[model samples]
Target chain A: EIADAAEALLGAGGVKVGGALRGRHVLVTSGPTHEPIDPVRYIANRSSGKQGHAIAAAAAAAGARVTLVSGPVNLPDPAGIAVHHVETARDMLAAVEAALPADAAVFAAAVADWRVAAEAGQKLKKDGNALAPLALTENPDILAGIARRAEGRPRLVVGFAAETQNVVAHAQAKLARKGCDWIVANDVSRDGGHQSGIPGGVMGADSNAVHLVSAAGVEHWPTASKAEIAQRLVARIAVALGPQESQS
Target chain B: EIADAAEALLGAGGVKVGGALRGRHVLVTSGPTHEPIDPVRYIANRSSGKQGHAIAAAAAAAGARVTLVSGPVNLPDPAGIAVHHVETARDMLAAVEAALPADAAVFAAAVADWRVAAEAGQKLKKDGNALAPLALTENPDILAGIARRAEGRPRLVVGFAAETQNVVAHAQAKLARKGCDWIVANDVSRDGGHQSGIPGGVMGADSNAVHLVSAAGVEHWPTASKAEIAQRLVARIAVALGPQESQS
Candidate 1:
């Protein structure tokens, strides 16, 4: 319906009063994907799904019709969002593909870059000291695939770069490599290099320090609650996408 | 307070009514522990903490004072219980150590068997073709540690055996190796080898099929919700612990 295409285009980059994201469809992904080693055991990242869930909630609060694709997490489904639960990276890709054709998409999931090339139907035995070696294979680059879509691509796509050392540098490279319009980069190291007393990085932590990277340049933000970061990010997205048209 | 010590010792080892666990103290661990590779990335298992949380809830419902030491999960704290959140297996071990002195303890967490010997203080770069190799070291065996404690160990310690093949045999071996009183063994393989039409044996599923392997023998249970399994387990524990003496 190209909902709010005009108002959004005209409004300056900021939170608009008239339900900035009203009538717009937004897709978001959160949590960590499990790449199976065997049916019972899987390799995974340490993502608690908090930040992505918060972002989905913020987008919904901003009046967007949100579709949240989540990996295995203990969290309850967020109110006012269509949630698709999945386990593996392939499942997440399929779910994302199915939920597409939206105004915007957010890729916040920590999908494993690789999966066991061939999973064992049965559990591998501990047979002696040397465990069975797992063969690796690359998973689909979901962000790049979506960004480089020839048709039906989202108007705006945001990807996250959770790096420790060269946070901004890696995020910049990821923006180019992944072909996404915006990158939300954050340092997730726990060496306490940031301002003392502020818990900057690490998963499941309530707070974050993020940078909004785009062709316009990098906008570093102060350490804040994950909920607050989500709100501000949603605000930026609303400003870029503009306000929604009247509801049917 | 030798609560329920007599009846528990004499009961036929099953669920009994009348708040059999009243005034009893029980401790439990749930979820998968993360082993850091670098500051930002980690190796982890695909555990949703559902079973562990359900067990904690069930114990509380049976009138026991429960202390749940959990790894990173998004679940709301269970009512009427104390919760200690942790991240890594080491952190989990520490938390469990600090939460000792209970009538019983349940080790339901998927503790990592190995951790990167040394964590990268800074973000490890994805340089060139090969990423840095992850040198792993053995993690502390929380269940075995508590089970074989020199003093003040819980009287009825329980451990979980998430195995794929020879589930009962492996569980029996673990019971002996870990020196725990009981072992809740379950097949986590996904080969669909179980009775047809039933979804069984895997992580992240809402339901479970488990075997309670104790010194007495193995008790095979029907497939049931995680909550139901927790309830039945607590019942057995109560019966094992017997009836409590009158409170002060």
Candidate 2:
């Protein structure tokens, strides 16, 4: 059913499955975390969870046990996946931690780096007086925390870098900083329009042009539908993990 | 078709239209204005635009020529209404100004009071250094700008106050401060849950318990579906504006 839905969404002939990740556990995070300033307002990123959700769907299609931790998104829960819906960065981190001990983990969520230091208990009133600057506090870095873990770490930890400039350089730096095995970098700038010519850039766009950066080298993948990108990435993950005993 | 869709969403037997507003012009603003932090990040309110859209649909059903200037919302354009889509408060204000000289205007949009003073051209990097406090500048008060206008003011200007505390008092103050004729106040606090046993608070919820605050007095309305509330409010608007030759 999940494969069928993915195929339908990504057009026909999408989501090829060979049971490459059979008997393996894969964890995925997607969408933008909302850092609340008050009851009604929050700071958010532009992630639509298309890539991450597609990745999860692909993993599931490959016969992997997939646990998807998602932030608030408009997309429906993909069939045949253990999905956990979360709101804030802290919540997302907790959810990710709870779903750990996977063969691979993908951090595609556009998590907010800073949240309002002091979230108001009530809705903040905008009186005639000049409004005060919202104090800032750093949120828990899920990718760094998980990747740097000494125990029960995923064999392959893939982080995403949605950059506006120096795409590969940023991804390389992010790979080192976050201690992740691979970084999927995508330029989300207005000028970085995908080959499909979809408007509004890659954050929420269907098609993506991504560079898979690892310790060995960077592989610049052509712009393709998010579902196709997911399939390719999952195939690479399967290759990196080698043939599992269950698959054999 | 507009009436049918509204009825379907609001459930069957909804949308009571008496054609009281026939030959009249009704302007409405809906949804939450997104203040950009950068290309990929933004500040947003939790408004679902359900109420405002319902009001617009109700007005259209009442045989009024309706203009809806809306911000970012996950809703289809209501049939039989001239819909103008916008993003930020500035854009919404501009759209509202362009759609002027109406018999009644409903300002239901949760416009951001402030925006980043200096929006970054690129995505702000989260280097190891301590982040700088975001500077915010006041946004143009759309309701006040139109309500207090010396020329071309809508005959009846209605402002909506989504408050967590002092709902009626805040609305009363807002009515005088903005020079709007009426204020529709809704308590959006976590504790101020609607009479309907539905889960989340009013911002994105289906049911609403609203207060109609005018110079005459306050009318506390029972918790009802947003569509029903819209119908009731439109009916009152038609009454307030008096009967027209077309209606007669």
Best candidate according to lDDT: 2
lDDT of 1 by residue, A153-244 (tens): 99999999887677898899999998999999988765533544322245767777899899888888778788878877877778778655
Local distance difference test, per candidate?
Answer: 0.79, 0.86
Once superposed on the true structure, which residue ranges of model 1 sit more than 4 Å away at CA? Answer: A1-26, A46-67, A73-82, A98-104, A124-136, A149-155, A191-209, A221-248, B1-25, B53-66, B101-103, B129-133, B150-153, B191-207, B222-228, B238-248
Which pairs in model 1 have colliding backbones? A8-A242, B4-B243, B4-B244, B8-B242
Worst 10 residues of 1 chain B by lDDT: B1-10
Docking band of candidate 1 = acceptable
Going through the candidates in the order shown, the clash numbers are: 4, 0
lDDT of 2 by residue, B66-152 (tens): 999988898999998999999899999999989888999999999998898888878888885337777888899999999999999
> Comparing to the true complex, what docking class would candidate 2 get?
medium
How high is the lDDT of residue A190 in model 2? 82
Error of 2 at A225 (Å): 0.4
- State every prediction's TM-score relative to the real structure: 0.76, 0.92
Tens digits of per-residue lDDT, candidate 1, B1-248, equal 22244335324443343366899989999998877665555667657788999999988888889999998665788997899988889999998888889999999998877676777666554455323334557788899999999998998999998887788999999999889999998887655234343223456677888898988888887787888788778877886786677998
